[model samples]
Target: MDAWVSHAGIFSATIKFNEPLQVAWVNTSGDQVTPGSFSLDPLKVKSKRAYINQTVPFTIADEAAFSAFTSAMITQPNFTWHLTSDKLDVRALAFPTAHGLHFKKDVTLNGMNNFGRARLARRLQAARDDPAGGIVFSATTGLDNSSAFNVNLGTGSGANTVIKPGSNAVTLDGRLVPQTGTDALATTFELFTKYLNGEQADVVATGKSSIQADGRAVSWLSAGLTALELHVPFVAPGGAVSPIKAITIGDMSLEFSTHAPWAPVSNSRTVLAAMELPFGFGLEIEEISNRGRCRACQLDG
Candidate 1:
């Protein structure tokens, strides 16, 4: 049996993903001169030769997770091109049109609550009365009949969620864009190598990431990737709401984990198991590392 878990009030915040797409060029016959890569002439022949011919063109793809119900998407800190098309044609600009581009996404909290609470009062009651007296709780959620704790909560409108009462208004503001071709990736790699060097591979940039590879070497110049940065926001209850207190049945304490998987679409095949707190619980977010997995939990006193 499952217990009813409800949010005392609305949760809201803005989540930013600073995932930067990088490009790097390797395996060059010459000294491997990058766009702005050069050394001072011994004789001081040319102060700045501007070896712009050796540069490449690329773009980065940045994305944010936003509410699907939003009527419009907002672009924060819009990106601009510093070099003109004429500069690109004449090779006056080192990056030119061939330079790399990076696109990012950010999601804002716009809904009162991300999800509604689920109640398991009936199931728990049934389990308590069962003659066998064998009731165990499991976090794994799926449709398999073999599991004892496989509670079916229904689908679509019938699906259970964590609902908050007050301030029913909120929104998740973020961006989503497609990034293709090797040109952009290559350039991105180059920038990455220059900024951090080979010794610092774990240095995370501004955004969360999830990069996938085609199973082939991207370049001998850089490391291969499967997927990078898939970040979600940490939620905290706001507005008028009572603090959630731990629920207890007899001497046994009731608790659940809140760091659950987030899949925005309702019809998607993937299953979600949210960490549910007792009714009137408040939300809080803990800062975590930007790279790899970014997870948070909902707790009660």
Candidate 2:
């Protein structure tokens, strides 16, 4: 008898910016300029990573949405473009069929600018007048990878700030690692307990998550502690048991840290922002049985 293993599932996630991000633009004079701090809307993503080396990509192209926000900022006479802080904070929630997980990640990067081109200035002017004619920028990060680098931000180092022409292309690359803290885990436990006790109705109603399994909606009081574990069995040929051929399992884990004003206090149910929870699954194959029966098997038959 021979058997094969399989695992499949889906996940829904919501990402939100926890704090205002400073924005800056530079002119041809090479001087750093400060625009104003801006906040982004929440983004919802649904994806599945059933194999290793798979990456999830997202893009936004709503010029009108950005134009409406920036138009109001430009009206302020005191508005200057500049990065207010060196750190960025974001919060994320991942609700998969396996479990409900949360993450908080803090990214610190040296600010740089490249908006010094006549063409770029013209494009900026056009973008201000036309809702469909704004700029588009993108960024990507390794969900399950890490890297290291040494950087110097002091004046005289040409690498201190990023530069780009106004009408040209720009790409910024840097290492971003998860922040260190215990608040995310504490929140996860609290939420799990709430889910197990039928107190997650408010969480679900807020459009934060929907918990279900086996093609049916699931409640905390109904699943108990086993809500996190999902199992599926495969029967062997001829109802006979033999050595396992393969094994596949899903891996779901959380990584995050909390800072002042965002961290939860004792007995508080507040969830922190600035987290990354990269969850996925993979398979491993073991020994393969021979086409012909082994001596022990033949004798038994």
lDDT winner? 2
Model 1 lDDT-worst window of ten = 65-74
- For candidate 1, lDDT tens digit of each residue in 98-214? 223232222122221212221111111111222333222211111111111111111212222112333121221222122256986675455334323322122221212212232
Q: Judged by TM-score, which candidate is best?
A: 2
Off by over 4 Å in 1: 1-32, 35-210, 216-301
Candidate 1 — what's its lDDT?
Answer: 0.22
**TM-scores vs. true structure, each candidate:** 0.14, 0.17
Q: Rate the local accuracy (lDDT) of all candidates.
A: 0.22, 0.27
